[model samples]
Target: MRYFILFLCCFFSYSLQAQAPHGAIRGIWVTAQDSVLDSKTNIQKAVENCKKAGINNIYVSTWNRGRTLYPSAIMMERFGVAIDPRFGKRDPLKELVEAAHAEKIKVHAWFEYGFASAQGDSGAYLLKKYPYYAAIGPDGKGIEKNGLTWMNAFHPLVQNFVKSLVLEVVKRYDLDGIQGDNRLTAAPSLAGYDAYTLAEYKKEHGRLAPPINHLDSNWIQWRAHRLNKFGKDLYQSVKAAKPNVLVSMAPNVYPSSLQEYLQDWPSWLREGYVDYVVVQLYSYKLDEYEKILKETIQQVGSKKGQLYAGVLIGLEDGYRAKPELLKGMLELNQKYDLPGELFFYHAALPKSGKMLKR
Candidate 1:
């Protein structure tokens, strides 16, 4: 009996050790240190630093703070700094492709899909220009009413807008892939069924929406389907634009609940919209995280790119990433044979950045 137990333990241990982190996706998050097209920019320096850090991939932000970081014609129609604004004209997307290519690092554009913020006088522009796009705030009114806003993904214009925007970015940049930001997504609101969206639903289903205070399970399920369709369509749009450009997404927590919330990540994966996925595993407990991560990875399997465990800062000792947590993630990579791990943000990484070095 003792010998059998020892053999079983040894077999599992051997299996764990022999398993290598498998998949093509590996790397870290990236953001602009400053303006997107600033002339003083040293693209090579930034890429080299990432390469030195052992990061083989860099997810670069192209838009934030009501600014589109790349030279975007779609954005020119939206944010009026200057048509073909000089920095807008600079084309960081192209630069990223070239620079990262030289370093042999894959570069994916990071887009905050459902959220947009304007920190300055531009706030009014968000309100007046795109009132229909904004979400309903806590008070059941447009976020614009509360001085906060994000585009309603359920809206057709919004869908077309995101699709076209993604196409244009990829066509211009020739990037390795595209990824969505986690917090940048919507919180799943039935209220976002704005007039246009209601019209769309009505048109499709041949009926008016369920009355307020009357939650229709069928309507909710159908709405969820529409959302999943939208996500798949987004993936299709990017692939159609550039067949080789990888489509990756970072979904909100709990895939099942999120589907109703509007993300539908599981369906996206099973149906195969995303080629790679960086799940946000910022939990504090090493043991719990490991189990959750392993199950998540196992669910993803070896066919799709090995899940890029989304390791982030601020999760207790995991955030500090001292002895156990960091080491454990690395160990998880080895045990699962995952593609590798990815950090959540560029600025959040250590100065040396040696922890993730290739």
Candidate 2:
């Protein structure tokens, strides 16, 4: 019976490998900030694990603390948090990218813009340096949520500068792609449109600001457009700088929340800015995950690009997956012929690298 079981396993493994997704984006999301690249040995070990497991792509980093991982010339004053030669730090991005390429794996640089200053360090610097793009309350008071600082998206310069900094990474690195997390839509029903946005809105849209007490449709719509613009400009900038490299976006699934908190990801997908996007479905339930996957893929609507379904492995959010989870997910993959599946973070992959192995 044990031999019979083994036979079945080998059979499935070979069969799956024969048809494994290729020419399709497959990888895990990794970061280089808030955490150092696990020692070079570990970094190579992780890449080796991925190659052995048949994973072909990795999304790593270039920006943190409003600072670009690559050494900078422009952001030195506004958000560049480091100065010493260590600022560039021994070609961190290059080594990672090279390792991945050596194993036939592709590396895409991940950029988490919008919310800056993980703790209290960079927040205070940006606020004091550029109050124009810095956060302020409706009462015209500066807003601070514990330690997370936000950039004023309404400022044209803010958008341009952010896009340029991101472009710097694309220009400098031979990245396989760009992994962009559209993380700054702010919140729905969030208060404090502020005098900065109000004045800008009047000038751009030719309308007096609506009262904060009432939800403003025009304002919301305009914000969504700006969000779309960010994606458009960033994608174009990266592609223009490096034509072969792809672009990816990590966005939440809830549509309303995306519009209110994320600037409307649907529009970004439809408009063709994102080369690919992973809907962080973060689902634990087999059926629910499949449902969200179907819904998100439906949005791509014949656009020829990769759509990696983000799986929630460890956390139990109704989408918490267990042993049967991979089986169920593979069932969906077979049904739709999905290009690949993406786990939220590099650390989240099962210790054996077995689930995403095939």
Candidate 3:
């Protein structure tokens, strides 16, 4: 009887351990537009929903569209607007940090817009005030690609401005991490024709002008290197401010992330600039998701432990990932031994929650 009882206890313990999710950082992004941040009550509800869903981390958008979700002395000093006017003196980040921490959820301040200024507003308010920050294209106009207008990410002043925003959040908030998406250290591949960039290129290359072809191999490498350097600097700056806070990045998948947007995240990982990378592996198809997941695993090599898959759960256009597909993706993550996953937004948690429990 004693031996039989021991066997049963061991079997149940093994089963329970097997049922738990595979990673340390099961997370979700809470965007500024999400109603979860609309009030303290909503935030509490969101945190409870996350707890039930098995989400342990929340990436809250702090910066977007030339403004912050929290009151900012930086933006006030520069633009005279402390926070996004829509919230009216309420600091959603403060409320969210308190609410999420109460639930034992780690919060990361996400800089959603990064160096890009506006989506379709041509440079928006930031560039309207600081025209020199514009990331000029070969056409001698501000770079606009895929509806997002650019800032000169390679320029020193722009880099410092972005650094200041990140450091301010690190200093002000009691948070677990800080994050930047694809737009953070990345610029449209066609950018860098601005006068400042051109002058620097000329100075470096025996006083020669940059090639007219934006896709020139040498040009691509040079721009990617600049962005990579900025990423390292930004990572160091964040560490200097808060040694314990994780510096997370969610750049798009590699190779293309370099060839298209100049993100160079593999270098960021190899150099230890990012504590972990949540590669945006947003795919609606199961086979495609697996394909990319495999490729990502192979590319990261030994750094798999520092990787998290960023799944697309919902979109603003009312598209939700099918439950079975979400389940299959989680299974794939477990099969591949990826450390964790972060879904795109908060509203989709209930669907993922059900899938996670099952």
Top candidate, metric lDDT: 3
- Each prediction's RMSD over C-alphas, in Å, is 6.7, 7.1, 4.3
TM-scores, each model vs. reference:
0.78, 0.80, 0.92
Residue pairs with backbone overlap in model 3: none
User: lDDT per residue, candidate 2, 228-277, as tens digits?
Assistant: 67668778877788888887777777575454454576666677777666
lDDT of 1 by residue, 261-357 (tens): 5555666667877776677777666887787776676566543343567876432233355546666776776676565777766654555377654
Q: What's the true lDDT of residue 118 in model 1?
A: 45
Which lDDT value does model 2 have at 188?
A: 32
Specify the poorest-scoring 10-residue window by lDDT in model 1: 16-25
lDDT of 3 by residue, 158-203 (tens): 9999999999999999988999989988998889999999999999
- Give me the candidate number with maximum TM-score: 3
Q: State which candidate, 1 or 3, has the greater TM-score.
A: 3
Clashing pairs for model 1 are: 20-337, 21-337, 21-338, 22-337, 22-338, 53-357, 54-357, 54-358, 62-69
Displacement of residue 149 (Cα, Å) in model 1 is 2.4
What local lDDT does model 1 show for residue 354?
A: 70
After superposing candidate 1, which stretches have Cα over 4 Å from the reference?
1-22, 32-42, 82-89, 113-124, 137-139, 143-148, 183-187, 200-208, 211-220, 256-261, 298-306, 314-320, 350-352
Q: How does residue 232 of candidate 1 score in lDDT?
A: 80
Look at candidate 2 and give me any clashing residue pairs. Answer: 62-69, 185-261, 283-319, 284-319, 284-320, 285-319
